[model samples]
Target: MREETFKKRKPKIVVIGGGTGLPVILKSLKEKDADITAIVTVADDGGSSGVLRRSFNAVPPGDLRNVLTALSEIPELQREIFQYRFKSDDRNLDGHTIGNLIISAMTDMHGNIYEAIQLLTKLMRVRGHVFPAAEEPLNLHAQYVDGSTQTGESKIPKKGKKIDKVSVTCVEKERPVKASRKVISAIMNADLVVLGPGSLFTSILPNIMIPDIGDALIETEAKVVYISNIMTQLGETEELNDADHVRVLHKHVGGKFVDIALTNIGIVPEDYIEQEINEEYLLQVEHDFKGLKAEVPMVISDDFLLLTEKSVYHNGEKVAEEIFKTAFNSQRKIKKYL
Candidate 1:
């Protein structure tokens, strides 16, 4: 009976980030015995999301749309339909995805992105909570090593300069950027807070740059784990290693907040990545065990690579297993202390 009860216990996890990587992790976590809350970045100002952000002054929907689909219990066909993008000569609708448009319309109806996401989470039967990091769209600013700064998520990396640091400012309003109403509470309540398998400067840092969300992460009793990216990114993390990733995050948060670091030791075939895949991926991230040890208390290094379609990604199932185990172990230790 004790074993059965242990198996049935659910760990509350809050995943924070945006971009292509966020949804991939969310999809895998949905299959686990974990209650999940996704705190997504709204600092996107590129692609279809950017166009909508400019047109409707709504929170960029692309990341939120992907997150919604990843956690939704809806049928596969419906999910495909929601994600479907139109290709046409018509300039107005050609680049916009069905999900983004729907989210834009919903934001208009609800008068805010937070409420829009909440209602859609139910309508689509999303298994967990999804909240925007900020209520309004935000602009990302990156300071380069040369003392130059660039703004806009899509525009930052395009400058091809090494970034020193990044920050976020309110886009639609001049007021200080704020996390969505539920974001702080969710982080404080989580059993584990997962940072990223996403872009370091653009996707992950933008969420943490928000004052309240960063504070919540620091104050939360939950263990913080970073799913270090497997490959280095061009114009972003060009030559960064696993430890550099942790160090940068630590600096942004003002202290060593991360308890664990998940490092990928899997090998990627040198010639396997196709041209499209190489666009962002410069090389495999070099390992820096000594540096990682200096930042985090624990490091779990393993073959977390998933290669397919001429690209590299984290093995989501493997990652979810480790995450659940960590959360469960921490809970057991806490209970013993109590």
Candidate 2:
């Protein structure tokens, strides 16, 4: 009876980070009917999001927009329209995306981003919650191994230097970036907290470095799982193995919070990625299973790669299955103890 009851209850899963990968896992989790909350990074100061952040003095809506669309139950056409980007000859709105503009407008109307996201999520019929790591736009600062420093997410990778550490600050003032009460609560109360298949430095760490969120991650009773990226990124995670990723995360969070790591053991076909076309993927991430086992309590290795259209991605369905399986077994153990 207890086993049956546990199975009936939806697992409260909180996924942290930003970038394209976050959404892929999110959409899959939604399909599984997990109670989801996405804590996204707002430290982006790049391209259309950067322009809007400067113009409107709003939270960078790019990451939040993608998360919203991913968990939304709205019609496919409306979702497309929400994600549509303008490519007009006109300079003003040429590179602007419709979703970014809408989110910015909504932020203005509500006078706060948290409320704006709540309202927007309701309208989109989002399956779960989407909260920005901070209410305001955050500026990402990186200290490279060579003692060099850089600000701004887009420009950080351009330096071509090894990043030793990264931190976030509010754009308007020299103050600590804060995650809202709800964001912290989500982490504290979650059944499982999943990190990345996204950019290690820019996307995932930005959210983790926020004091309250980082602390909650460390203090939370939930099992934390990290889905390691399939390919190595040029500047951020160049030549980094799966364990190196976990070490960076632990170094930032100040604790060995990641209980399990989901690593991709599948191989990408050689000459599969066009260098010019897919500049982001520098090389396939070499697996160091021993090093990975040292970082986390348990390592889950699988063929978690999805290759399509000359791009490499996590096979979201398979990853989500592993996530729920982990969460379910973890929950069942807790229930047994009770």
- lDDT (C-alpha, whole model) for all candidates: 0.89, 0.89
lDDT of 1 at 12: 81
Off by over 4 Å in 1: 1-8, 274-278, 332-338
My TM-score estimates for the predictions, one after another, are 0.95, 0.96
lDDT of 2: 0.89
lDDT of 2 at 48: 92
RMSD of 1: 2.7
Give the clash count for each candidate. 0, 0
Top candidate by TM-score: 2
Residues 214-274 of candidate 1: C-alpha lDDT, one tens digit per residue: 8878888889999999888989998899999999998998988999999999888777754
Q: For candidate 2, which ten residues in a row score worst on lDDT?
A: 329-338
